[model samples]
Target: MERRPRRRLLLHGLVGLALLLADLPALASSLAAWRITRQGALELRTSPNVSLQAFFEAGTRLRGPRVWVDLPGAPSRTRSIRGSGDVREVRIGRPTPDTTRLVLEFRPGTELNPADLRLVGTAADRWRMDLRGLSRPVLLGLGEGDIEGSATVAYSPPAPFPTSGAPLSADGLPVVPRDRFKVVIDPGHGGPDPGAVGIGGLRETDVVLDVSLQVARLLQARGVQVVMTRTSEVDVDLPPRVALANRVGADVFVSVHANALSMARPDVNGIETFYFSSSSSRRLAGSLQGQMLAVSPGSPDRGVKAGRFFVIRRTVMPSALVEMGFVTGGLDSPRLANPAHRRRLALALAAGVLQYLGGR
Candidate 1:
């Protein structure tokens, strides 16, 4: 009887100790692993891939200026990855017990928007911070592009650096083209996603699709192979749209949308073209914006902007999101409603693509 009691006590002690040991790591914030993965560009992913687990508790504010986190408790030493792409190295710093910051050092002229840097959940306990827009410092060489068919072929960054070979554009930078340049055109809203409703009850989905189809036709006629995310008014999820463009190895991706301002401020209207924060993407956007402005000389030019929209951000090609006109703006609404105007916009967009493609 004595021996039995002693054994039970020992087992209980061991179990309690094990539990305590397990809880120890949890007491201090645990950062599992920091690793890099690449699609067309490199991204830093946290182990367990979720948000900083216990490190950042509730009320922990994610302060900007630069990415710094104020946690409930102190975390381990800062984690670092040496220079890659636009990132010289990304450091997770705990300068003080309650304050932690993610310090990203970028090379000169590398544009980084707070909106572009994000923590996206990848798995049950995992999340990924995609920095593709800010940097693609290295290319592992192009994947075999010989695979037949657009649905099967996946295009990658050419082995040469993005700025290495090819004819200089008007801006005087080398832009290499795949064997056959391909373009993906995404119509903004479809199916149940009617987008913005404006004067005379205009449906954004219908108007955008009509204009997108026209754009596709013009590009196709110009001998530039074109892929449409949807030809009919059917709902297409954003992921699949991006996947289609990536799978086909698109040279350029353009998402067409019509703008809508507040009902109260119906007068705010113009053409705004957005690109991811990259020189190539910005060049593409500028080209398109210029062409649109030239064609619609009377329309207000909202100018080229930068954004991390899903279609443009995810696609590993020169991509842009074009907002043709404001459906709610009294001056622009009537023009967007006109079929001729839509056609002209399509032609202008096609011209922009051609210009970006070395006027081919």
Candidate 2:
């Protein structure tokens, strides 16, 4: 009887221990590292398990511009790092017991536009906040009326193309009016970022650059004002590219890139285009996808997709990102490598833009 009682007591103690373990909270995530890039952007690396929530707030004369990033379920901690240019300092603190916060402080008299500040990265743990290439004045005089005045800018629709005497391009598409329409062409990757490398040692940066240049020439010849994100070999971060388009008030923004897959799967190849929110962007993507498929009948039609890519999401104007074809694919590699085929592809893309503009 004494042995049975002891055995029951041991079983109850084991059950109590499991209940205690189950009631305990999970381990909190943390910031792994952080640094400022040469381009004057703040880059933060978080623990792989962290999910970030961030926002920017405009500052006044008393305080500086600030950006707050919250990491939930994290412990209280305080840290600071010096910043350059517009940013004066970066601080990490605990705003709440369960939330760790990161604050970016801008220099005094600096007026940061919320649109100009962007946080971009695809990964859950890696992010970059870029404030460079701000077209607005950094310093503004403080006035009593400034607080009451409306900051909204009136929207003006683009001037319609002249119905009569509109010259037609050799491809039978209507030419855009001279100096009336602007298009920003962004070649996806360049310089240090080689993008996708595929069959026969073909580089995505090289192919996209060539096609984008050709597209620019085609558009320029048709009297459309063309702006290229990169004209040569150089690394251009995502924020500046969007900033340029927004600053210039571009009518259309298109980022050109080649898709890639594993070399072992050469069968995966297609033309696809992506757009963020907005009906205009969706229509533009659809037009581009249709035109690309019309040119390369043999290539698979991947169709238009909705994506949250930074360039397309941040640009104020209608934007699309086009993936020409897979670099690793058996069929796409040879065509992308050929100069004449690239020209054909460029013509198709240009036609798509013209088609959209004309319809609009």
Candidate 3:
């Protein structure tokens, strides 16, 4: 009888342990299901000073089950957001278009750490990640199969905004001017890949998309056609992107993206330009960098770099990728998330296109 009571307690204890073990996976599954969404599509902007904002694009919905969304001028931070069913009001802290920032919520006990960030590049724009609690040794890789376990993935960027800088051909023959050039803007990373996330919940793709549209509009207004690789929120592969660019006979290809880092106190903020592996690409990158700095005064010049990006590597025309800014640095995030700063960036890029075309 004495042993019976003790045995009963032991049995109950074993059952409790089993139950606890069962619940762990459930907890993890629940954690995996936690998601984030924006009511209308969020606008991406470049920052000036310490300001960041997401001007809402009404009727454009950006809904997903991802952990977080990035903003301009911020580093990659993971989060889970949801709505209260009916037309949920999304708030970003500024009154003006350039200063407003959207708000999000997360599960209780979730940690927000700034130091756990590492920068990884997608096909074009990149992410500044804080992957402290998201599994271990988080990674960012390319290819469709074998995605790293628990690692975030990025989507291809939207089509580049077309250029109106068609002046003359190499033979001194003037290139015919179209009403609007059909430009395919590529904003890299989507779906599972939240490229970079910084303060005010900034995202890499979100930031590039905003700038891409602005660049598109600027060129369209100047009588150029514009097409986007992935207009809404969708993933695009490299081969398809290359085919699209070639299909449209893109006069110039510009991939829009942000930059990131992975180090202690690695506050990296600067502007870098890239072209395919060619001598002329260097000149184009240099020219674009100069033009970008013209509008963004006091910005760091990382100089033109040489890299064999898949999109740039495969494209047959003049192609370049622009790293507008970084989201992780103390001084960079605010600079990236500001609307004025983005506008200036767009203007500088436009001027660069003009110069490139005029020179030819």
Candidate 3 residues lying further than 4 Å off, grouped into runs, are: 1-176, 180-182, 263-266
Q: Residues 34-91, candidate 3: write the lDDT tens digits.
A: 1112221212212211111111121213431122222322222223223342223223
* Model 2 accuracy (lDDT, Cα): 0.67
Ranking by lDDT: 2, 1, 3
Model 2 agreement with the true structure over 161-231: per-residue lDDT tens digits: 11112232436655666677889888876544568999999989888878777777777777787777665
Quote the RMSD, in angstroms, for model 3. Answer: 19.1
Kindly report which residue pairs in candidate 2 clash with one another. none
**lDDT tens string, model 1, 131-152?**
4354554333321122122122
Clashing residue pairs for model 1: 48-125, 48-126, 49-126, 49-127, 50-125, 50-126, 50-127, 83-88, 85-137
For candidate 2, what is the TM-score?
Answer: 0.55
lDDT (Cα atoms) of all candidates against the true structure: 0.57, 0.67, 0.47
RMSD to the true structure for each prediction, in A, is 21.1, 20.8, 19.1
- Measured on C-alpha atoms, candidate 3 has an lDDT of 0.47
